[model samples]
Target: PRIIVRAIRTAGKLAVDKVKELSVKIDNKSPEEQRDLLQKCAVTAMSSKLIHQQKGHFSKMVVDAVLSLDAPLLPLDMIGIKKVSGGALEDSFLVAGVAFKKTFSYAGFEMQPKSYDDCKIALLNIELELKAERDNAEVRVDNVKEYQKVVDAEWQILYEKLATLHASGANVVLSKLPIGDVATQYFADRDMFCAGRVPEEDLRRTQRA
Candidate 1:
């Protein structure tokens, strides 16, 4: 009976101690102290995870993630983790803003500027490529000049559409459909950034950000 009584007292003491710890407001601590505490907590939380071996890196990422959000109650739903294939576990990182892996293309990708500051972004669902005149529409050109005019008209329509987009003061362009080589080169020539085939989820998240 004495042993059971002693165990009950110890359990009560532990509970009281935990309550006191929990009651302490983290904001009351200094920035450096808070960071240290969070790092230790992150390490402990991931002790059983596969990333435990790289705790130092993962710990910093966790601390950054928490500090960046800076919320009284964590809005965990706002944070997203995308597990991309390839690269080591050490390659994992936390982006303060949204990022996409698959949307960028090789065409004119290297020519355009990579980073932007306070730049306007335009999200489009329409294709930038030249479209057919109409469904089941056929044009019987009598001569070479006639065929050239038909081609020029289609090209002019594409060019005008691109010009209209450029006039919108958008330096960054994202589209759900293919932007194609012609449109890609157009943006690159102006030192702007453009990407096509962007996922719908990415578009929504970008808008929110």
Candidate 2:
């Protein structure tokens, strides 16, 4: 068929043709010009949204958020969005840096330090809950004395892990796993900030920040 002949000729020509890069490079633009362009693009993108009337506010926030990144590659995952109740769309402004809500799994969270300056932060993926091994192995104990030993062993393991964490001098401890009552009390006793069950995205951003 004529179609097959045309395809063959086109393929032969393509095989002899040189490839060209098609990605746009916008590095020539000045910073101010780039910011203006981003603001305009942001406003245009939001034109169909409910808060289009507040495009000016949101567009400025978009530009500020993009400009705040200190990396060579801009990733959308690095940005976080938290919704606080009782705030108008116009009041929705961008936070300059990473911000997440407080989630306390245990009591005495108030006893911990409210804030820290120049303090080391540690990100953990391990669990600090005082429970049996994650394997769910049942302890076979016939008497109260043996049960006491089992509980003590669990406490000792938790204490060793906490001790290692404390030795790192990280006042702010954030973990993806659960940090239960005993760990929370230990942190409060030491006047350390501890937050558990943090989202992986927030942890990544915190690491970068």
Candidate 3:
């Protein structure tokens, strides 16, 4: 009985494979013929049990979406798919912009800049923390005044960097590395949308957009 079931499954798989092979044999055909073959295949596939009865609606939606692209050559990476749990399949639609999976480092600043309209964005590929060079030597600060000066200077540098970004009209800041608490607070006080530790690719796409 197991052998009979295995043979039946194998035959069914082979039949599906053969149908797929024959359906795509439009390489040598003219452009019109190729298009017709593709349309027929689309119809057949959409009519299958998997797609339910929304074949015509889905087919038209797909064609309209492709036609809506700005250029003839469509790079699919420019498209974003956001799936919501409560909506029907027909409720799914295409959005015109790229969406990154990043959140603001500070929850308090989320209410600010609800939109990016006319907002300038700054992309920083570096950490917002302070770095020191000791030359493999330890310097001892004997006086409290001198120790305070060093601390003040380090903070000044970080403040200046943040100020520069703010001066550039950057309402949004995306960093590829962790943003120190001081920097995050500075941005939050300014009501800026700052997100840190974002992926490199996301930063690049945000910059391009």
Candidate 4:
């Protein structure tokens, strides 16, 4: 048993060495020759019975997704794959821009804007909600009138932030943090596109685009 184990380990080492030798040979080749070799290897590997039969189709989908970026060097991390179990592989397609799963905080907002030709976007790292300076502050509200005034003051501050965003000629607002209902309603009233609570990485990619 010990002899068999030793022999198997030796064989594994030899296999790894052989792969390293082949990689060095490939690296020493011209760019054109290396590309040709890579293409041939990919084709041969895809032809193996153990592999998925539709790998070529999936490969094309990946290639198309990367090419859609239109950059000389690909930012592959920006490519997002959304898999649905019931769909055929052929039904898969690539989307040009960043795709994110988010919903409008306000119910009445339109999913998309009517015009995008002159759309200027604003990206906000801060939340549209108002933050209290003191978490535990004692407010002496004598009556309903006083309480109403306090609530209105908070709303006014949130409104100002929303107004500032709109005043900046921002047709689309993307926030990395949550946007309050007041802010969302304000944006909806102006027919502006607003998305809140977006992932930080996605926001960075959108800024780059």
Candidate 5:
């Protein structure tokens, strides 16, 4: 649970930072512009990858988590590939697969994911407001809530996909975008959403787009 909390905390911090960041960006733009920008950002966030060190940090954290849980199954030094589980993993290899079984399942869902830590940073975090840039006949700007809902749905899908991969057994090297829920947890405590720490901007951004 300590590892879980840490993962959540890490994700929380990162998401908070992202929200704060994007909010400022939104503030700089008009409502229509801000909404558009958020859409772009969401798409970008989902489709991108993270830097090496950042990915590495999350990777290491995953390794520690697996080791912590499966310690009894393998010796400390024998934890690497070709060692145990045929480098398969003693637990959900943060560096390996999503290993849904590897990590604790929270929020009533399971997703396997490789560390693929970059997913959080690299992706744009965009919403699906323009299912093709709004209907031409509809000149009126879409409501913020509309875009937010779309974005939220997309983010949720993204999070689930990532987590499923991790939980399944990709415990070596992750490549796909992280599941949004796991991504959310990757930033902070699971309680973050419940406690209202999840940035309002992120939530708003998610729902409309």
Candidate 6:
């Protein structure tokens, strides 16, 4: 049997944040004041229990699935390993087989999202393609918790680098591509995030976990 990790999206709650801000009231506020308010609100949301909530919700389901793969590419390391959290991918098939599925599930994909007119096709194809890899190959997925901590440790270093770059105001457009597809958008997001473009609160939440 093929094993795959799946993540579910959870509703978020802002503990102190049921306050309704009317657009009119926001409109009356100066731009500087508005920026300040938003900053504070963002900080409050991060500081409150809501930070990294989705991660905790999702990781619980995905960690073991990640371990079962025969091979996996880590975004931070830019290489494939013989196992899910260590080593390197020797071929495109290996990367496609393991990394692709995890990325797809992480985005909270499903048949429901597939019906949307604007839903990204590349992302869906990623899921389909990885499933194909699993069926075509003899590889087996296993548990990766121990190696995952090391991978995560490296990922954090990369994330801090990217976050600092983004904070310096560097533009984050795709630098080069062989195909025109949002197909790789998540990879880009993961790379930047591994490098550190995820919203700060999200990063902090991951750090705490």
Provide the clashing-pair count of each candidate structure: 0, 0, 0, 0, 76, 14
**Tens digit per residue, CA lDDT, model 3, 1-209:** 99999999999999999999877566799967755555555667788656557666666555445445555555545444455568666775555555666554654555556576778889998778666666896657999998898889878888899999989989888888877767777777887878788877667656655
Q: Which candidate comes out best when scored by TM-score?
A: 2
RMSD (CA, Å), candidate 1 to true, equals: 8.8
Q: Taking the tens digit of each residue's C-alpha lDDT, what string does model 1 give over 1-209?
A: 99999999999999999999887578889999989998998999999998889998999997887677637554655566788989998999899887876675757878999888999999889888865578789999999999999999889989998999889999999988888788989999988888889877778767767
* Per-model TM values vs. the true structure: 0.66, 0.82, 0.57, 0.66, 0.20, 0.19
Please report, as a residue range, the 10-residue window in candidate 1 with the lowest summed lDDT. Answer: 70-79
| Weakest ten-residue segment in model 5 by summed lDDT | 190-199
Weakest lDDT window of 10 consecutive positions for candidate 2:
17-26
Ranking by lDDT: 2, 1, 4, 3, 5, 6
- For residue 73, give model 4's deviation from the true position in Å: 6.6
Winner by lDDT = 2
Candidate 4 per-residue C-alpha lDDT over 102-174 given as tens digits, one digit per residue, 9 for 90 to 100: 5556664554464577688899899887666586887889999998999899888787888898899999999
lDDT of 3 at 184: 74
CA lDDT, candidate 6, residue 97: 26
lDDT of candidate 3 at residue 8, scale 0 to 100: 100
Predicted candidate 2 versus true structure: per-residue lDDT over 51-143, tens digit per residue: 799999988987888788876675877889998999688878777777888776688777889788998899999999876565867679999
List the lowest-lDDT window of 10 residues for candidate 6: 121-130
Name the lDDT value of residue 196 in candidate 6. Answer: 17
Better of 2 and 6 by lDDT: 2
Over 4 Å off in model 4, which ranges? 1-51, 68-74, 84-86, 102-105, 111-115, 129-138, 143-145
lDDT of 1: 0.85
Pairs in steric clash, model 4: none
